[model samples]
Target: MPSTVPDSLDGWWCDSSTEYAFVGFSYEVTACQSRSTLNSEFKDIRETFDGRYVRLYGACDRTGFYDDVIDAAWNNGLGVHALIWFGFEGGSEWKDRRDNLIDTLWNNPKAKFVTRAVQFGSEPLYDYVLDPSDLAGNIWEFKWNIEDLGIPVTISELAYGYQVRGGAQIVLDSIDVLDAHILPYFSQTASTGDAAWKDVNNDLNWFIDHAAGRKIWFSQNGWPSTHYSGVEPNSPDAVADVDNEERYYKLLESKCEFFKSVAGGGVGWFWHIYADWQEPGYGLYAESGKTKFDFKPRTEC
Candidate 1:
């Protein structure tokens, strides 16, 4: 793993659902829209938000949906954190899908320039889909296969999983980068705004202590702008509207700057998404493709 870390946090998690109406089995979420609509959304993300990189989940299927996503991102001048989806129940099928996706990316010329890294999977351990040892073994195998490409490989996990679960250390040691999802809304104790920052700070510190000097990346982080009925019942107020979303983003920027100063720039943060989908309130842009708020990062306190 390289000791150097990216100096700025300017990435987003993008998906093909907005256009393709694909079923995201892992989360049971679906986005039903047109390809043109999705393209326009990507354009808005690039031009309006100033996003430099995008993280995508899952491998390119036979339909080549993700290939189109990679194309759109590169054409819009965005790098990619390409992720491979792993479903624990179907080991053989999952391996085949993973291989095909990798082959598609490796063979594509655009991918050569836009791929920032290849993530093995997202939140497999946290979801209990794969035990840490099994996940670590799979990551190691994938890492070996992709090492020739000279791109870093990692697995994204919930920040506290490493400390709460027994086997995350092996998984952590296997990857080139440490990707953790830090969502204060999901904490056992409810929190919002500046109070949420404390939770995030504690999580970040936990990662720093266990990461063994590896670069730490926040694979997903964001506050939803609207409250969803029945979802997050325990932390209902954790969801924000336009105004509070701005507050959270600013707080996030400040925290990132602090982390950069302490970690010496070996950290990066990717907002949860570019636009809202089935999950409302997380998108920087609304479903109608309007900017939700001004989201400038604070370089200094």
Candidate 2:
């Protein structure tokens, strides 16, 4: 809720009341410390917004601080949906940390109002090599954990944007919901199977068909100011280059519309108003307080 959010997109879906309607923001939990810090950031977000719900996701990389961050967000009146297991995997303190975090969040009545996500691994299918057995077993384990914890679980992955067609069915059959992640930087690469936005749509449609009565969410999708290697920062030409930060913004806008079109299906953006995160040029708003995208939507909202 810092003073770095756009005025558009507020109440865009006020009249919507369908299963596919979705409009929410996402925030990394441990980006800052103290309840006030979180509150101020999100406060800045909601002040200009209305209607669209905010889905605060506890970034799982700092699994150790999940509870602390969740407690802060909740106390500040930030609605949290999808408690992401930021970097949790099959064997990483699987039982204790997972259970404890779920216990902490679910015990609260308000927390139950927020959608829950139990990410198995960060891009588990791509980052790690899990054959059918391993993949199915890990998914089943996470599913059981989700059911036991009494929350819906999603499998969040980056390449799912392209592979969601076949991959989605495989996952949907095994889990309760499929969470697909589409990063602008790597989304067009071969790993995604198809780089075209239309292809991503096709994959999403396929998911709808095969999801049975289950749900599907575009869990993570956003653009970076620059591409890998930090290239194209100062390119002279106007050609589309993944390394160009400006180009990333343009790509993100178009992608946002596409995701928005599927709002009823629960699509959540990856970042809220940005802040420096031990990296250069990633936050939606640079640490300098200059907003990166003039229209960076608020995930806190």
Candidate 3:
């Protein structure tokens, strides 16, 4: 539990933890990439990163999207935790959208077979459109509705939403596991990647102390590589930069055992993204195929 990070930036952390980390990433289900490219992407994840699953963020309503991505995962021997993204602050439309996806899944055999879980929403409570209790009620509703298909239901929010936000505990029975998002950069409490890892560990420990009966999964978690102009994160006291992102990757490898320990508030995390896109650019691989850091996760960790 002491600092695994090197004392100076001149050295990198060595990962000796023997525990196999059940890693994952959020991959874009885009038609822009050729079928071979898609296949290669999933192949790299399973072989290169030892990934067990992938998180699909959007396009759940489309039948084609499911057909495409699920097949890719299946071919690569990976399962998927598909998402129903209601990326909004307020809306009654999400209810209809949720039902539409259920309808989509109910009809599709591949989706039913390859899908491990269906996350109802991303940060609905954190966005404040729905209160914690109301959000929990929605998740409960979704859980039972998808029961016949045998897919577990959950919601993605900050861990604080489950712990501090009111009435979130009421929905525990309805969910298979808690898919909370953890971003210490956004928390603004830590100044460096080492501190951020400690912050994350402390947060997970808090979950162990408080939410003792629940299995927590950080379905969305990562540090940004850069802002708009290739500078540091837009904060005076923050460390959301390439250096910290690289540092975070090292720490992740070093603490693989701690992360995957099922009994110790362990979480299955999907690094928030595989590459940069529209905004808040948290890309491991950039637009021009440039890697922000040469993050070979398991190799020589």
What's the distance in Å from true for residue 206, model 3? 3.1
In order of lDDT, best first, we have 3, 1, 2
Cα lDDT of model 2 overall?
A: 0.47
Error of 2 at 234 (Å): 19
lDDT of 2 by residue, 114-204 (tens): 3344555445655544554466676687566556445556566654532533454455567666566644344333221123355455556
lDDT of 1: 0.63
Best by lDDT: 3
Kindly report which residue stretches of model 2 are placed more than 4 angstroms away from their true locations once superposed. 1-22, 30-32, 49-64, 75-77, 83-91, 129-132, 138-150, 159-170, 187-210, 228-273, 296-301
| Best-to-worst ranking by TM-score | 3, 1, 2
Query: Where does candidate 1 have its weakest 10-residue lDDT segment?
Result: 19-28
Question: For every model shown, what is its TM-score relative to the native structure?
Answer: 0.79, 0.64, 0.80
- lDDT per residue (tens digit) for residues 1-301 in model 1: 1133233323322321111111011111134234565466556556665555566644444456556666666666666677777654546555776787678666775564567677777777766667788878888888777666667788877876666677478888888877778777766664565568777878888888877767677777767677776656356456457776677777776554365554423556777766665357777668896768876543223
Give candidate 1's error at residue 100 in angstroms: 1.7
